[model samples]
Target: MSLEHSGGENADSDLYRIRHSLAHVMAQAVLDMRPGSTLGFGPPIADGFYYDFVLSEALNEDDFPEIERRMRRILKQGQRFYREELGADEALARIDEMGEPYKREYAQELLSREDLDGLSFYRNGSFLDMCEGPHVDTTRDIPRDAFKLRSVAGAYWRGDSDNVMMTRIYAWAFDTREALDAHVTAFELAQERDHKKLGRELDIFHLDELVGRGLPLWLPNGAVLREELEKLAKELEFRAGYERVATPHLARADLYRKSGHLPYYADDMFPMMELREAGDDGEAVKEAYVLRPMNCPHHHSIFAARPRSYRELPLRLAEYGHVYRFEESGAVSGLLRVRGMCMNDAHIYCTEEQIRSEFKGVMQMYAEAYAAFGLSDYRVRLSRWDPEDGKRREKYVDNPEAWEYCEGIVAEVLDDMEVDYVDGPGEAAFYGPKIDILCRTVTGREEQLGTVQLDFAQPGRLGLVYVGADGAEHTPYCIHRAPLSTHERMAAFLIEHFGGAFPTWLAPVQVRVITVSDQFDEYGHAVVDRLRRRFVRAEIAARSDTVSKKIREGTTRKIPNLLIIGEREQADGTVTLRRYGIRRQQTLPLDEFEAWIAEQIASRALP
Candidate 1:
């Protein structure tokens, strides 16, 4: 699903060229197998390539083998690729002769463009495709065994659900069979660590159509995990001198316009809420309010609530604000992409001279947070501004000096801290440059875990100022950071990172006391009560099942520690402890075991 290239390489490599050519060959084979099929766009992706087509008969995975065989035959024919350039009018005529209505429409659109000179077409065998020329010389360049048809799914014409749906055929191509096999193994491992499946199996979260698409209802266990993460964030922010503040979930529309997010982020934001009031002339005036898509605008207002002085420089306001975004139905996954999320958001108002130290402090906060969660594999991205071309200038604020100054400050701070990072141009926010933390999941997926943005535009636009030491008013720079990301995304990342087996500090139920038989049930309750008294999440499983069965059930829940109470343990006033993912069992006194578990939770151990 990720189309981003890997290994610090661009999309123009030889593998990319091979994949692109394979897509055209696959389309040709599909047309030969199903004669009346119509083709849409086919692009080379990160792993492989996929093509969209409309067929007279429904196609499924069962049809892949036959289609692949036909593709092999075409490959064996050793057809040479030839490129042809033609005027748009001539290209449309050729497409019409081939009876490809969709291709004809595409060619006509390109012809309507005044800037374009002509169209480029590639031909191999009896098939011709409109494309840029970067294909292999002949069909023999494709390895017969290096390509495979993956699967079939329904996709909209251009990813818009309102458009006509087409059957999309996915395929994988690689330089060699060994590389393909390794990728296959990695993909299978990723499937095993998929958070959606683990969320259900672990009773962490669920999505119901009755509630609505992309809205997830957190079960009790999941809520506990969310709260634990929030608690950790609050503790860190508090120690770093951040003041906690609350904000409304809905705000007036003009607020976003002032922050410069209205027209830019409108599509991703939920629809506006309009309220009407009667006027004196019998006319109604409407005021629009939108669900908060971000917390920065509101924080800006808070900074401008009163006049600030130089003594109050570096004012940090923090919040665990809940935000709503109108993600398209197709883009929403279980917890990774959802309609509602709680952001561990905060903004710092600091003098220009304090930007470096403030930014470094935020990086230190990230280090502490990742250490708490035992997250180690992550990279930093310093997202800078793109060259201000006509349209690109409109995309960013028109302050070249401010952009350069802010970018220089971030780079200096990163260099001072000796942090490893990569440059990402054109990935900054509309008003500022940002440092994005990218964490690599166990599944070989990189996720944007947190961000720290330096904004020199919003404070000026929102009229935020403070008196300098010289008794003159000056605009303050803003630093927006979230070391811990939204709870939904963080949970998904942790679930996959730990394979649904959370650490002691973050686990929903740290201890489960199991009774071996009916007679020892009393001892099991006593242990649960004692652990609960110490604020440990504990439960007693007193079901009348075999001890092995109870152990298996507890293991499935992934509880960090399991205490088994049998006749001998009851007589000895002790318990047998079984740790998850370990084969050894150690017997200890009840009080000693309780103290050890409490210490693990208090220290936030990674056990």
Candidate 2:
């Protein structure tokens, strides 16, 4: 839904008009190549534009040069676009002259629906467009050197399956050649940092076709990285006063029914598993088990499992919960969006008074995790109910005061602690307000990696209560959090974050011991064995190739450190350390190298 531009609207946005005009020129170029090309729609996107077209023939990379040449030829002439106020029949006849059936059909459809006393067309020389107004005075404004024909992708019409598929062309246009060149340079850098490429090259992880899409099978090296992440999460949880717990992968349908998941979020949940009772089983039960899509429901059951007083308020229970969801085939991405993922999830039951301190504690936990990963660019967002929507009367607990009080509590904490954040409306979950962390990757994409949500209603729905100081019934507020998000998404992010050169603790193989020649084999083997004894991840290259070849292989794999032992180094009991992506080699005593390696492991550097 967009505002109609009847030659009068706020078209004067803060942008160079030159860029916008180029979009129309690009669309015209495509139409010229194949006049029969059925046009779906084209619109200016972020920084550039794209047009979806139903073409008779598919194209590849080789077609770009010809398209660019065609576009330049059209631009050089500086065609005059005359506005033609034509009748409905005239518009249809003009569209039919171009032999574009889709355009003719669309114009006819618009005539049938609208009270069209007159319809206008913009004819730039011979090229005409059914545009709603606001173009440059002429075609000369388009910069010749400031654009590039980017990629091609297939997109459904109006993004619906019921309509025909269209080939969408992505193009980027800038005000100057410098800006365009900078964009292309950034794209090249992003390609180098692609996690999927690094994962395969580094052998950190792999997805087997037999294992299935969205379900990644960790190799031996990848398992090491996962173990390190879990170890760090477990330690951090313990220090934060969190008790570890485990939940089953499947739960009865009744469990989700109470949590209100089946009715609202059933599409995302996996297909159910049905079961019939064994004759000897109690009650001759008929049953179904749905793969758990979340862990909050199970945590609520734990709270309801026992009676408690306010003394145990702010009970922090944590788990590395594994969840499964049925993601669309198109939505499934390498590691970012997967069917199965493990999140560093936790739940806290706190009283209204404990809200501020609990939120501060979670913030501290978030900072610690990000610090460990060497991530600097991040901000917290306060997600609240839409102010325009009137105080949302949905799943929020009956306690209106609690909701108001808790929001103030969070605001005060943010001000008191000097936490940086921006407020967002209509972004909060139905149950409560939330704090979402937006993390930016090295490649410049912003992802809402994790969040902490305050829930009062869902806990009440399950009849969870804690005796208050007044010795009466009171419902507890639950805070759901996943600081590290899912392991699948986080790991995928980290694989590219560090560019596969993981810090020592999570480097699959922290150090590789390579013999400069066959003569130094004994020393290399002994060094590897000693490092292994000290619990360092070190491996010897199994290939019987030249030492330089082995080093190149390690470089390709993005291995963090390489230890080379030559004949002189073997006799001297010294090792030359080569850091990843850098040629500078440092010579360290055997004991010092082992100590530094051990210290890195002890510190639990980024996974």
Task: Name the lDDT of candidate 1.
Answer: 0.87
Q: What's each prediction's TM-score? A: 0.83, 0.83
Candidate 2 lDDT score at position 394: 52
Once fitted onto the true fold, the runs of candidate 1 whose alpha carbons sit more than 4 angstroms away are 1-24, 34-46, 50-62, 75-146, 152-168, 174-182, 279-283, 286-288, 388-393, 440-446
Error of 1 at 188 (Å): 3.0
- Candidate 1 pairs with clashing backbones: none
Per-residue CA lDDT of model 1 for 262-327, tens digit only, reads 988899999888788888887564888999999999998998999999999799999999999999
Model 2 has an lDDT value of 0.78
Model 2 residue runs over 4 Å out of place are: 1-15, 33-43, 52-66, 81-123, 126-137, 154-167, 176-178, 277-285, 386-416, 440-445, 604-607
Question: Which 10 residues in a row give candidate 2 its minimum summed lDDT?
Answer: 1-10
Candidate 2, residues 407-458: lDDT per residue as tens digits? Answer: 7766787788898899977677877888898876655667788788888678
